[model samples]
Target: MSETSWITTPVTADILRGALELERTEHGVLPHRLPAWARAQSPDGQLAMAEAQPSGVRLVFRTRATAVELDTLRTRPAYPGIPPRADGVYDLLVDGRLFGRATGTGGNVLVLDTAAGTAETRPGPVGTVRFGGLPARVKDVEIWLPYNEITELVALRSNAPVESVPPGDRRVWVHHGSSISHGSNAASATTTWPALAASLGGAELVNLGLGGSALLDQFTARTIRGTAADLISLELGINLVNSDVMRLRAFTPAVHGFLDTIREGHPTTPLLVVSPLLCPIHEDTPGPGAADLSTGTLQFRATGDPAERAAGKLTLRVIRAELARIVEQRAADDPNLHHLDGRVLYGDADFAELPLPDGLHPDAATHERIGERFAKLAFGAGGPFAPR
Candidate 1:
């Protein structure tokens, strides 16, 4: 067959899943986890960039194509002091199983020249991600893009015809949390804790794991409420405590409002509240976490004083106790709500075994361990997230 006979399909929102909005770029569509209205309300560049990168977005469709190609412009950010991050990974799943994988190459580069205290952003070459030798029979296919990279999908080409995959009965799990919930130090987009747990639990995942931005905000809860989900999980407290963004008095009310908004939309959805994982630095101390750049390596430091605990300051210990108390009190009226201490998954002993490399995010191994532990604890038999 000639090239003229090939079929090319525009990757539109209809065939996309796990993203709230798809904005058209010069080359392609940029997927945003947060909708337009939400983005407009906040002008924070960090949040905008984080949400624009589709961490949980994937291409869902049905086709008999033996070969497939996706054209995209990926933004690769370079940190001056440290090595350049790895290229984003693309995982292909055929009939709900891992079939093959591909790596995207060459796009835009956002250079953070920390040594010179300068930054630069510029246009980059487009790259093609290709996969071949798929089964000849009609089957379900999922292409999971890298969670960290900002990707603008230009087009999708396949040898065989393709159509949007219809939503099945797979339970949709919408999870909201911190960088830990996001792919922070995870191996890949598909292997994030929530992704791994969803796989083990046999549920479809809609991850809202925004890095450095999982505050118990009204918009986040409103996002969760507006979306359709069977199960909901909120991994809270880390960002709040580390940013030292709130005190005890305000923290309690914020938590309630966040949950109330979500409940307004999904009053009966099984909701799970997870407290912070064990972090020795902030376990006792407070934070307005400062960066330790002395060794030419990026590290975090706790800048908050410990004695402030008496002033109603927030700490991991304080947050956990408050979360447990809040959930216990609410559960009496709402039996579906449950709380889990994140320490059980990554407690003091586990931290001693697998220490955090950044003094913040978990290493890849820990992500897997946490995923497995969560799968068994929450999705296991008689667990709160167990299928009905």
Candidate 2:
């Protein structure tokens, strides 16, 4: 078919799901997990990059076109010594089922040097991903963007006119966490732990998993508070410890304040507080995690001494204990509030069976396990998010 024969549709907000805001950039429309106000408050580069990655964001519409093509400008990050990372994958879903997957040919590259604290962007051309041979009848279609790459929608074309679909009756689940929840090491966008769990639990996902930036920021908490959600979950501890942003004394009150702000907007919504998963490197040792490129492969290691606990340096174990205590104390008057130890999702037994590939993030298989466990624990019988 000729390119001119295809119907070109503007990528508007009506066909978008899971993004909190859409930015009209010079290149195209960029989806953002955090709203403009929140992004403005904290200009941290890591948070900006993560929120722009669109872990659970997707384009959803109803159409009868057998072929579709999407033009995108993707920005993938690169490091100094390590090999180039694989191109991000885009998943196509038809009638709520995975139909196919594709990768864009070329785009921009962002070279990040954490050791030197520098970043450089190299411009490139736009790339197109084409999907064809779909059933001709009317069906709901979703194009899930890559969870790990920054992407801007340049154009969307189809053989038939596409119309926006109405938001269904699924419960909206708002989730906040670190890179693991942001789809690190996950095979695709829809397979992220939160995304997989949302699918299994029959919930609409609004993923706010900002990698390396879940440091109990007030702006992030405020964003979550303002967003409408039927169920809310906050995954705390990993980022705080790895960043070594605060001590135990400050963390306790910060947690209280974050939750308090959310309660202002959602007085009785089911709120679940999740502590950090078991990371042996930071389980008992304090962080300021450091990169280990010793063996020509990227890995993480805790730098703070274990003896620093006496000085209030936080660790995964300490954070988990404190979080459980805080949740227990708060749940007395707030019946809708609950707590879950993330170890229950990926613990010692799990680690032994499926070790974290990078000594930090879970591998793709582990994501599947965590997603299954979360769906069963949070959405199953007698669970906090269980239907009333």
Give the residue spans of candidate 2 off by over 4 A. 1-4
Q: Please state every model's RMSD to the true fold in angstroms.
A: 1.9, 1.1
For candidate 1, what is the lDDT?
Answer: 0.87
Clashing pairs in 1: none
Worst 10 residues of 2 by lDDT: 1-10
The digit string of per-residue lDDT tens for model 2 on 313-356 reads 99999999999999999999999999999999999999999999
Model 2, residue 29: C-alpha shift (Å): 0.6
Global lDDT of each candidate = 0.87, 0.94
Q: Assess candidate 2 and give its TM-score to the true structure.
A: 0.98
Off-target runs (Cα >4 Å) in candidate 1 are 1-5, 112-119
lDDT by residue (1-388, candidate 1, tens digit) is 3323557998988789889888988898999898888878777655666777677789999988888899999987777657667778898899989898889988988786644766588778999998888888899999998888889999998888889988888899999988888888787778888888988988888888988888887788888999999999999998898888889999998998998999999999999999999988889888877667687776888999999989988999999999999999999999999999999989989999999888988988999999999999999998999977
Could you estimate the TM-score for every candidate?
A: 0.95, 0.98
